[model samples]
Target: MRHSASFLPSRKTRIIIGTLVGLFFAIPFVATTEYTFRDVDGHSTIHWANVFDPAKQAAYRPIWTGLGNSLLLMVVTVAIVLFVLAPTMILVNLRFSKLRRIFEFFALLPISIPAVVLVVGLAPIYLVVGRSMGTGAWTLAFAYGILVMPYAFRPIQAAIDSINMSTLSEAARSLGASWPKTVLRVLAPNLRQGLLYASLISVAVVLGEFTIASLLNRQNLQTALLVVSRQDPYVSVIFSLLALLLCFLLLVVIGRAGNVGSHKKGRRK
Candidate 1:
């Protein structure tokens, strides 16, 4: 009688699968990168000189401004998530556990709202902000914070769930530590991975965010990239490759943070 194989992929099969998945992503990246290096005649040549041409700097000024704006949005969005969502999530989980589902539902509401719809709804808010705040790209942070809540909330929740928040709080309180002390000292340190993960996701989201900013008559990285594509296709292709590389680096950062967190947990145990 023939024996059934193990109900899992073999080591060789896993390697094959991993290779194919990497190739699936790598193919497009390779094509774009190759195209970026090609001249108008389609001959392969390093385009670094053209990319940094002093005469062409003026042409790419909008893109540089957009990059600065995007980075600002990322920082503000991460801060909002940390200061607002972190405390609120901890409070609900510790004091109003029953409201957890409601909190999650609200966090997820943005995902259901399309970009165009969100932009339409936020128009009045933008008008008020523009009038009060002088219509800078920094104002985009508030909307971006809302958009990234769904992604940011999950890692934070998962991190809290991994540790016994109630026990830690009680222990801290028993030691005469206040609630803020417990959250900032006893709990926050342990949630480093979660915070890093949330920040990484938020950065990625802001980098690619275009619709709301565009409709609001603001510029961002993605919108700037679109303009680049229309004006200088090869340069835009190079930028796309660089964006992908940045994303990969962020993922690597998250992975390292996770490993570090795990190591600390293990040492504590």
Candidate 2:
């Protein structure tokens, strides 16, 4: 009698499936020849007879600049988050248990808070901060910090959770490694994905954040897209493509985090 193969699919099969799906999606863009048109408000104000009209192609360049701004905003916001929150997260993992739980709960607390409330609550705060800090994207970055929490907290928390931190701390103590050295040296290396992961999520979140940036009167990528859509629906479609690309990158990152080196095993009591 012939034996059945393992029920689980192999990695190559999974990759093939993913590639097919990607190609299926890519076909529509390749097959279609029309360039869609929209008014400044993002609505397809005029369905240009030719979708890829020469004029439409020329106008496409500004959207590229807008996309650049979007990427910049994402990068800056993630930087700020990593700079400010990483040490705080490290401290929580080290010194405090009950407080750590509370801190984490509050970090997640921002998630449950309605988007409207977040925008509403932050609008005034940003207005004041903006006045003191001056105008433009960095102000947007600060607002983004709050908006990023729902997405940003998860990876950092996962990083903290992964380390046999308790064991690491004990080992550090036995070796006479100072607390800072243990945290900075022994613990930080294992957190590579977590470090990069949280920042990457922040990029996607800040890039897409409309409510807070809108309230703050900032010119973030989403707001630019929204404003442009009124006059051109096709432009909106292109923005959709850009947004989708960012989202796909975010997913790839979360997927990558799953493939990191094996967890270090520690000794028992």
Which of the numbered candidates is closest to the native, going by highest lDDT? 1
Which pairs of residues clash in candidate 1, taking residues 3 or more apart in a chain or in different chains? none
Off by over 4 Å in 1: 1-5, 9-24, 42-46, 259-269
Write model 1 residue lDDT over 57-171, tens digit each, in one string.
8878878888899999999999999999888998999999999999999998999999899899899998998898988888899999999999999989989988888998999
Cα displacement (Å) at residue 159, model 2: 1.9
Q: In candidate 2, what residue range of length 10 has the lowest lDDT sum?
A: 260-269
Report the C-alpha displacement of residue 209, candidate 2, in angstroms.
1.5
Q: Native-vs-model 1 lDDT?
A: 0.87
Candidate models: Cα lDDT each: 0.87, 0.71
**Alpha-carbon shift of residue 71 in model 2 (angstroms):** 2.9
> Estimated TM-score per prediction?
0.87, 0.70
Model 2 C-alpha RMSD vs. true structure (Å) is 7.1
Error of 2 at 195 (Å): 1.7
